[model samples]
Target chain A: MTRPTRPQSAPAEAATSATPVLELRGIRKSFGSNVVLDGIDLAVQAGEVVVLVGPSGCGKSTLLRCAIGLEQIDGGEVLLDGSVVSGAQRDQQARTRMGMVFQSYDLFPNMTVLDNVTLAPTLVRNADKAQAEERARALLARVGLAEKADAWPNTLSGGQQQRVAICRALAMDPEVLLLDEVTAALDPEMVHEVLQVVLELADEGLTMLIVTHEMSFARAIADRVVMLDGGVVVEEGGPDFFEHPQTERARAFLRTFEFHRVGR
Target chain B: MGAEFLFQGATIQRLLAGLGVTLRISLISVALSVPLGVVMGVLFTRKNRVLRAVLRVYLDFIRVMPQLVLLFLVFFGSASSLGLNFSGEVASIIVFTAWGAAELGDLVRAALEAIPQSQYDGAFALGLTSKQTFARVILPQALRSLLPPSVNLVTRIIKTTSLCMLIGVVEVVRVGQQIIDFNRFDYPMGALWTYATLALLYFVICWPLSLLSRWLEKRSSR
Candidate 1:
């Protein structure tokens, strides 16, 4: 399913040949009269973790959903690994290349944790039952929930359920993973464990797009950070976006989040 | 006292024969109605405005018209008007099927609509097409909701079978009437017992259905 993905400009291509596995250009979405995303442009290289941080209702989740083809975008294009991933069509095939973990831990409550993880693999990928189960077991083990495989999703704690959600996404072997507030619903102490699993996945070369409230975790793990306010990108930078913010908006936004004092 | 004797004499034979007809009509009508109703429900829920308007009119007509009136329309009025010579039993089946199908269709639509919109989106995100999602995910969940109402409908069908006697079908109530007619002098109280026993039999059948509805409700809630 690989395509010839040659970037246009020599310098831009050289910088990008980490070559972005996912790109969104001039993406715009609106609900009737209210526009949520206006001319947004972003890209993620292979194995990079890009965290989208924003205040509530700033349309961070909407952007992630648009990229994953869960919600249709009213304008512009989404490319997954140099292939068009959005439009009136392209839903199922595009979704197969990416996986999403919803904030509510949308694990199928009627299914066991193993079945939840294995569903996309067996159903979407057409893997046999044995292969799906095996993959589910290995991924569950990675998430530290191997023993929780046969348990119902409702029986697991929020943290464990979120981990299972991650395992479910991994089973798809997606080229890019979209995580929309995977730990927002978790108990504060439990958030670290789930974030650690995501950090580990990023380390292991998974291309990830995450929307999160945990600023410190984002600073530590993300290769890039994109700040959104009023449904538009306010800033995009590396770790220094947190250290030496570029704009007053970025500084004010960063200060609202209580980061632990490193030293005076 | 003599009524008790008549019941001991040949009441058992007649009641059994009547029971056979009751079971036969109820089972057949339910068999035809449940599936037909589910399909109708689905059709009515479609996005097409013209089709939706037609279904609304049909359902409203069915809901307002009494079953006895519909039965007469189908068995007497429509059959005769159309020059058909259908047997009383066949006519009874036709009337009940139409009645049950309409009611069942409404229940099916309610059940299907009750499924959360998220479930459909969930399946779509998994790459399942609309048909696959409906069959594998939506239908199973909808069927669970459809169960209690379906059982309730079946019980209703059983009770409604009594109305077939009015159209000259030899079902339980008609057989009871026959028993009373044959032994009026020998047993003054025989009619009371025969009618009472028929009520008792219907109660026996329907009480379990009521229990089943409760059970299914509990299961779905979990």
Candidate 2:
């Protein structure tokens, strides 16, 4: 099976000089007797977009959660700009540097869209309310949601909610954005709108680590693609890795998506 | 003659005074219980096993024992055994506040638990502190689900204040009984009229609360 050729960013070769913006070194995590991640290492450089792709339950989402300090790792360490930000050292202040978006948009239902976006900036950064709202409005306008400033979250469509969620995370001015299946909960028609917002963010050179099942999207946006199976990295490469996966597990995983890609 | 006795100016004043006492106990208990119940409810959601266990015992004890028994224990037993003298009205207040707080605490716990975990995750992801998350995010949403049932609790407390009569507190029911005994010889149907007035008074107070609860339930569900 062959994938359609598309414009792709050059690999993150330019970022090898300084410490990575986000790094997970020999990380291990388990729930009860079940080991979800085992000694995995990954790095996302400043302005790099890394997409983690694997079969369900392969720890892709868990790894993203660990990077943002939402989940405590059982072994190894997570680092942000060469400083440790995991385990006992993980604090709310350190976590603000990394933004995360969940599968469920999870917008605070009680607040309006503008409030949702400005909450972290005003509360955590101590930014002026006017400054925070101005930035939030600009972010919302960028996503074509400026009119929804006073709208409650439940009043918006799934795609619009996800877009507002992206704005909320971006408003924090995070050093690295961690997206855990952000498009997973949207309807088929809605997924494109949400993904389009993300694609634009990629073009603006936001550093991101995304876990997604959208192979075509992964190929289009990822500077690096890391394939995982059974909690370990099986193959890591550039966009062309989809056509030339170096491992049997990665090959098999990519093959499963071919059935969906046949007529397209 | 029975109707005339029931509507006498002095008898009407006595009934009003008795109702005032009932409202004072019920409203005071509710005011104290709602806030204390909210704190206990939040504690119930925490992961502290010892704290949870202790609260659980308090909640369960209140649930299993009757409020009348609690009133008696406080009013009768405290004066003799604990050597702490409390008036009947004071005893009734203490017992009802304890009962209301426990019942309302359970209601609050259910409301808090009904909120999805994703709400907390969303708040924490934005770097809001735990206290901020509770005050700003969790409490506002919980209050929506909490209001209807809480209004229902208010009505229950108001009705149950009638039980204070058993503890020698002259609430509305006690006032009605006194009127009946005094007019027994002069008015043949005085007992019936006085009891009917007492029932009407309770219905007037509680009916509006039930309506408010239902209205709130409808709004929150939306």
Candidate 3:
């Protein structure tokens, strides 16, 4: 492991809870004849960046969706911040405390970027409009697009839209943010810019679970890597797993995707 | 050409008075229908199976039954059976309003359902509650979808108001029939022109709404 030249920052306030920010136990889901998340188990500590990487149709997104209660688990439990999020003990409000960003950057096309970012805060958090706009502006600046606040989302580039979507997720002040293949939809040239913002968030010690195909992003940002295939965790480890994956499936999966050259 | 058929005092006065009644019924019925239609339309898309089944049955009954039959049932059949004593004009408004509400409700529901589920998913992921998400995200977006069908329903309601004549409400068409009743010997063209004027008035009332619907449809496509 490459050692940090400076002292690592303290974990975010969101991570200080006794319970893991998110925990899933034996999650199983299927679409009729097709089984998706088959008895998958994962836990994410507060302020930890957990990356779930696998080939398409491996149920990586489904697992993240299940974690957030966007999809009902056919079997098993999802717990967030020590409280159950789904099943007999599930509280819908607890699930709301976690935010999710989609690969498609599903910004409300009818709204301005500022409105899109501030929506949940104003509506659900009951923040006054002025405060919401102020926070939206700050988050927009963090994503390097302060001037794009009043612009419609359709007017922005793919990378810009994705970044705005990230800002939107952050606007909720969620304890955990789930990113499902956030950069996969960006152009090759634009992927780094979007990933750079995510890396910055990771550096700030935000607790995040990102499902990704971007191998280098998986390596540089994730404190822990969770590899999934055929609705199961094929392997789980640290950054080095990218270079020397243990499972045959993980090895084969990584071999198919070309990773960008790093540390030149 | 008989001088009696000419646009003199009484005939013109009667036409204007009939036009007023026609406009009043159309406006009031639409006012009642639009909001009712929107509510019914939204309710149709809800997940409650019992409500859905009930609404479906109600919508089917309304759709399959002829409007004229419904009008007679409400104004003539039910009014007499229930011993209510409203004048024909007031009964006409109530019957037409009910008809309009059911139609509009169906349109609202279709517009709500046509919206992609991903839109709701995207909003839910943002931490907005289902109610907030629907009110903020779904409803505004669905408005464009609702417009065209709503305009169509408005035109249908306007045309259907002619059925009021059977119940003895002296709307424009009824007045035209009265003129034909008196002047059938001298000039048949007087009634034809009167009916043509009524058709033109209906077109004037409805054409702008049709244009609005088209414009909304075009905008949403973008």
Candidate 4:
């Protein structure tokens, strides 16, 4: 058996000085009396693929949502290219630069796949209709869904709907893409098709922040793996972090997943 | 004996003229109420407590009172107390429009609420402004859910127009009663045939609306 190797990019050490494409600084959020994210800091430099892995209720999804201004943060701020994009400064224009795909693949049921993908670009960016449709077609074709464009969202399989969702996000030409457990709702068989698309995006050097429960896929795709536990970063390292977790908490978390050595 | 009076002395023409009045009342009221109801519905969804409280009071006031009471208030009370002289037709329109707007407003609110929260999040995540989300995403979907109920409301409005004759509007039912009284002895079965024809007329108008509502329900569910 063989496993595909991750495409290498610029070394993380050299990319430190450059402004991150998306940044979360000392982010704090709570629901009612319960705190979900507590003063957490993380960044994804241009073209970096950062994967967030944590147990249920650990706030990985909340962090991704806050980064895109979906959930209002109680404290701290989010930044895009070093400019504050959170709190009062957050606006539609600022949010447009970040794309997000959810687990449920929230495609507008009222629209065809092409319409779903073209909607944001034409509405938000004021892009010309003909040109936006052309770009949308190209994005859909790239995701192996060119033929499905005329079909209503409900007509497609779950995996296909998710692929169209990715196409919808990419249509915005976002500076950073956010994936929130994109495959959590998929059947075991359909997960691969969605993961494959994300891997291709990674190879194309698209900057992304991903939260996933699939340990093997996380290890395969992450340039930097950040393990979150109890609303804080418990460990952060390269893919080698999986081989030798630095903290007991990280080690204990990894043990929960049955390890399958890739490329052994 | 059966429907013999229906052919006597411009009876058919008189009934149709009265029906035309009923339809005019219904049409004008529907046009006024639907747009007003839609606007009220959108406002109802907002988180403003004071606005909702005021609108709730208006909705409850209209709901608790009978349509007959409303018609009397607008037609007789206004003329006597407020010194605002409105014809019976005008009063009927005012009362029915108020009633339709309130009922439709609630239906619109329920339809809007039926939309999952994720749809709003999805639209927002795509960078659509709040207005854009409502116009392009939220409203189009809400309209689908509300269509069947709205059609049903239209039928209700048309049927309820029969009540306007009580206030001396002399609509279809009123015309039927006049025909039945004028031939009571000569045409012994006049009342039965006259009332039956009135029922048939109502059925003719509302039956298609009911069918349309059912059709819309089926399509939306699919």
Candidate 5:
């Protein structure tokens, strides 16, 4: 079920062999008159964690959704590996290469935590149930939810559920994971555990495209940070982007998220 | 109207015969309609404008028309005018199915919708096709919320089947009327006793449904 992936660019193929695991070129999405994403371009390279930071309603979540094929993009193209995968027809199987965790924990309320993690592999990949369960238990134990495997999602604390959400996405064995504000709903006290799990993933070389309001976490984890404003990429750079923003738009955006104290 | 009259061997036999007919129609319609309603419910959740509009009209049509009017329309009006051949029992079954389907569809839709948007987004983000998302994520949650209301609807459908007496279907109420008609002079209060007995029978059937509904409500909430 794995198809050969095409190469993205000359340099990417030549020296680095660092083709973007997921790429979006001029992706555009509009909800009728309200254009959520207006011609955005971004890419997450292999083993890179690219955090998208912006004010609420700047379309960070929409861009993430469009990339995952949850929401259709009306303009531009999305590339998984190097193949075009945008518009009405998307390569659904290729999407398994990149997993996403939502702002809401979004764990299936009916299923046990273990079932939620193992679901996609068994159902979509047609993996053997025992194998999926074994992997699920290992992943759950990593998130400190091994005891909560058979527990309902609602029974777990917000932090545990959010960790389970990460585990669920990881169960797909995705090359690049998309995380859209996975900790936004957690209580302030509970946010650190979720971020800690993400930090560990980044350290382990899992490529990720993340949209988050946690500027400090973004600053620490992001290999590159892209600042979005009103459906457009206003600025992007290294870890220093938060402290020494290049654009007036980026500086203005970061001003509002004053909680981030990076590269002082 | 003494308690002794209710247990008379002859009265017991007639009521049992009527109960059999009532159950036959109710069971058939409930069995057919619940599955049909589930399909309609899933269809109702689709984003297609045409599907939504068509379903809205059907649900409204079924809900707004009185069962008696619908029965007459199907049996007396449409059956002969359209060259359809069916007995009163078939007509009753058709009518109750329509009623049950409409009610059950709305309940199923509501139950499905009650599932948080997060579950849907989670499924979509995982790149699950619509079918896998529903079967894996949405259905179990919907089923939990679906049962209580569905049981209540079945109870109402069973009760509503009594309307079939007007069309001469020989269900429980019709049998009660027959008992009253034949014993009108000799039994004095025969009509009163017969009607009360029929009501008691309905109560016996429906009260359990109410209890089941309450039980499900508690379980789901917990």
Candidate 6:
């Protein structure tokens, strides 16, 4: 390895619990006969940082949507703490327990950065406005946007907006966070600024399932890496999986990524 | 002679009284219509198929009929057919409210529908119920989109009150007509001067609204 991986920063949840925070069972999804995700199964333990890496159109983004109950799965069950969360009825509760950040950082344009963070608690959780605002301020400080609490989302840079998106999800105190290509939409210079915020969350022991194309960042942060191809979990293991792929498809995919890593 | 009648105390008082009646009709109709229009706008944007079709039919029905015909239908035609009892002023309120609401509702629907799906997804991802999301995220964005159009609608409704004159509510236009009739022989050019004063009064009332619409367009567009 040219660079050493960071030591495990995920919290003590793994030390105490045997159950995975998120689990996908034989998940199958397709759009009108074009199968996006064939039968696939995966599990993410509490406080485990699993990075999903694949060539484009491998169903990484769809998997995150399915996990959060945003998109319905065709066949498999998305389980949170071993309970089925496949129905639309369960989405509200599922969303509360888990948060997902999009590639575009879909922050509410009409609200300020602080209101964006506190809105759910005030409306859904009935959290006191003063308490929510105070907590939001602290979260803003954590993401290095303390001074931007009152500013609208449109005023922030792409990096700043992405970080605020992360903070917005974190404010809910969700057990696990799903990041769907959070840095893919950012400017090359701004990518690290957003990735840095994700890195801190991982270190704080927040369980996260990340879909990313940044091979280097994936290698550095993932406790386990999942490779997806043709809507299936082609292979999954530690960071070493990149250096050594057990499947022909994975080897081919990783080889192209490595060769084109310069172009990216 | 025209200038003498233009500033005459009785003539000026008659014009101001007409203006007062005009303002009252406009204000009352708006109070009734704006709320109904906002509700229509919100309902139209929602996914309820039944309500959408119903609102669509209602809006189409109102939009297709001329306001004068509606005023006559409610005030005269419906008197025996529908058995509704109201004075001309009240009838004006009813007809204008329906017309104003339809126009406003369409504006609202357009505004709400224009919001991006990403906004809805983001709001839902935050664990907000769809209602909560609408109230917090979707509605605010729609409000911004609807502002310029709303100002324009207000100006249109104010002008439309002139139609109430046909029903003898003695509003701005009809009162001006009465002034022209009273002085036609003695003042000779009284008709031209009286009508010009009416046009000026309408201008005064509607100009600020046009200015507001332009300002809102610039603010929201930016």
Which structure among the candidates has the greatest lDDT?
Answer: 4
Q: Write the per-residue lDDT of candidate 5 for residues A47-118, one digit (tens) a residue.
A: 677889988898998898888888878899988788887758766687777789988888888888999999
Report model 5's TM-score to 2 decimal places. Answer: 0.90
Candidate 2 segments exceeding 4 Å error: A1-11, A260-264
**Model 1, range B1-222, lDDT digits (tens) per residue?**
455654476678878889889989999988998788888999977899998788788888988988788778877886779988777788878877877888999988898888777676666666666886787678877887788888988998898888888888898889888988887887788778878888888888889999999999898767
What are the lDDT figures for the candidates, one per model?
0.82, 0.90, 0.83, 0.91, 0.85, 0.86
Worst 10 residues of 2 chain A by lDDT: A1-10
Residue A93, model 5: lDDT of: 86
- The superposed Cα distance between candidate 1 and the true structure at residue A82, in angstroms, equals 0.9
TM-score of every model?
Answer: 0.90, 0.94, 0.87, 0.96, 0.90, 0.92
How big is the positional error of residue A244 in model 2, measured in Å on the Cα after superposition? 1.6
User: In the order shown, what is each candidate's alpha-carbon RMSD?
Assistant: 5.0, 2.8, 4.4, 2.8, 5.3, 3.1
The worst-scoring run of ten residues by lDDT in candidate 4 chain A lies at: A1-10
What is the per-residue lDDT of model 4 for residues A7-54, given as tens digits with 9 covering 90 to 100?
A: 457648746678888889999999998889998999898888899988
If candidate 4 were superposed on the true structure by all CA atoms, what would the RMSD be? Answer: 2.8
**Total backbone collisions for each predicted model:** 1, 0, 4, 0, 0, 1
Evaluate model 2: give its TM-score: 0.94
Candidate 1 ranges with C-alpha deviation above 4 Å: A1-15, A258-264, B1-10
Candidate 2, A1-43: lDDT as tens digits: 1223324444455566778899899999999999999999998
Which of 3 and 4 is the better model by TM-score? 4
lDDT of 1 by residue, A25-59 (tens): 88899989889999789998876778899788889
Error of 3 at A207 (Å): 1.9
lDDT of 6 by residue, A1-264 (tens): 122334653333463557778889998989998999998888888778899988899899998888887777889788888888887567576779889899898898888999999998888889999999999999999989999999989989999999999988988898889999999899999998888778877777789999999888998778889899998888988778888889998888878764444566
What lDDT score is found at residue B124 in candidate 5?
73
Q: Locate the minimum summed-lDDT window of 10 residues in model 5 chain B.
A: B1-10
Candidate 5 per-residue lDDT, tens place, B75-150, comes to: 9887679988678899999999988988888888898888888788888767688789988789988998899888
Per-residue accuracy of model 4 over B1-222 as CA lDDT, tens digit each:
367668878999998888899899999999999999998998899999999998899999999999999999999999999999999999999999999999999988899999998898889889999889989888989999899999999999999999999899999999999998999898889999988888988899999999999999998887
Which candidate achieves the best DockQ against the true structure? 4
Model 6 achieves a DockQ score of: 0.73
Question: Where is model 4 more than 4 Å wrong at Cα?
Answer: A1-8, A259-264
